[model samples]
Target: MVNVFITGASGFVGSHLTPILLAAGHKITAIARSESAAQKLEDQGITTIRATLEDIDVLAKAAGEADAVIHLGFIHDSRSYAESVEADLAVITAFGTALKGSNKTLITTSAIPVAGVPTPTELSPGKIPPRAASEQLTLSFSSPEHSIRSHVVRLPPTVHGDTDRGFLAHYIGQSRKAGFAGYIGEGENHWPATHVKDAVQVYKLVLENASGSLKGGEVLHASQEAGITLKTIASAVAKRLGIPTKSITKEEAGQTYTFLALFLGIDCVASSELTRRWLGWESVEKGVIEDLEGSGWYFEETSVTKF
Candidate 1:
């Protein structure tokens, strides 16, 4: 059994991932910032470590003891993007220091938006959007000399699924508030997407085959749908909410959207062909619009929490 250390173990992706890993006979050491969260993990037969991303020593110690580490925790404050990236960089540095020259595996999170090139590829080289330093730090420790098998999973901007209170949820909530579902400028900009289940499986495959299946410093896109038009996403939400979909100016969008405005304006089409070829991974699930409209249970539940 692989002794895996995972940050963000109680969050959306991690919550789904832990059970799968356990079913496969992997032992999990998960980090939780609250007692309630820690208790939840412990209840599920996981070893809980009480700490936040700020606890570098705790992270380092946990990572040092594990056979592998998956870094998924990040500060979600969009207003403080710089601080969040800095924390990620520091946390990565700690993991690298602890696992240096051990050839142990480390998998961290990046976003498809960071693939600055128009057509995103696994080999596309660029600083991650908003925070370039963090990705650079992650890729730098992935050499044979460092002896750390490192990789970055570039997640699509929207990973939709059950209990998901992400960007799509925010759109639904805003649609309820504004009396209409809105898209920015013609809404032609495209955003890649994947179901949470599919995305988590990609992570599992990468972790299971880290030492052999993937090259160090490789960037894998977790996108199942290469790109779905913003207009399509808006139409889906509008249809669900029984509201008209309208195009809003960027200035109007700034006032309308909370933290998702900047992202709504971006067109990121990421390709996972290389990741699929290398890891034998494929996303066999409903696409974003289908999930958002037909199967997604989030809309049936409470709209009180706006995330």
Candidate 2:
């Protein structure tokens, strides 16, 4: 059984990931920021370390001791997105410092939005999204000279399932408030997606297969649906909430979607073809729209028209 250290043990992906690793007979040392979270993990027979992303020393030590380190922790403060990106860079650096020459695995989380399509002009440093920048930096630690097996899983903007209370939930809430489910433009812009179960399966596969066989600096996309249309998503929300779906202009979208306007207006489409070829990850679970329309829990939350 490999000894693994993981961050974000209490999050959406981590919550599901911990059990699968345990069932596979691996011991886990989870990093937590709160006593309640630590106790909860300890009760599950997993050891806990109290630390935050800011605790570089603790993170380095934790990464050094474990056979593998999976970093799933991220702060999504929209107002401080730049700061969050810097924090991610710092965390990766600290982990690299600790695991240097150990040839251990470092699995960090990234998103497809930041992994935009290749451009001809070459992406300027300032033009690159913080998440994408962090991903590249993590992969840089994978060379023979570095001696660290660094892997990055680029997730879809929407990682959905039965209990998803993330972006979709927020969108549903906004739809109810607006009295109509809205999509920007003709709603042709697409968002990539993956079921939480499928995502968990990929993580397990990566951890299991990422020894000497799977090379370091590999960037994998955890995308199931390459392009789930915005119209389709808006329709799902509308049908469930007994509301109408409408296309809103860019100017109108900013007013209605608020902080989510930028995302709502983006195409942000991605694929997992490479990931499937490399890791043999096939997503057989339900699609995003199907899950959203069928999930009773999802509708229950959106049923609340008031804040």
TM-score, per-candidate, Cα-based: 0.95, 0.92
Candidate 1 local lDDT, 139-175, one digit each (tens): 8888777888888898888898887777877777877
**Span of ten consecutive residues with least summed lDDT in model 1:** 298-307
Score residue 5 of candidate 2 by CA lDDT: 94
Alpha carbon lDDT of each predicted model: 0.85, 0.81
**Candidate 1 wrongly placed segments (more than 4 Å):** 77-79, 304-307
Which sections of candidate 2 miss by over 4 Å? 77-79, 118-127, 210-213, 302-307
All predictions: root-mean-square deviation over Cα?
A: 1.7, 3.3
User: Using lDDT as the measure, which candidate wins?
Assistant: 1
By summed lDDT, the worst window of 10 consecutive residues in model 2 runs over 118-127
- What's the CA RMSD of model 2 in angstroms? 3.3
Q: What lDDT is reached at residue 231 by model 1? A: 97
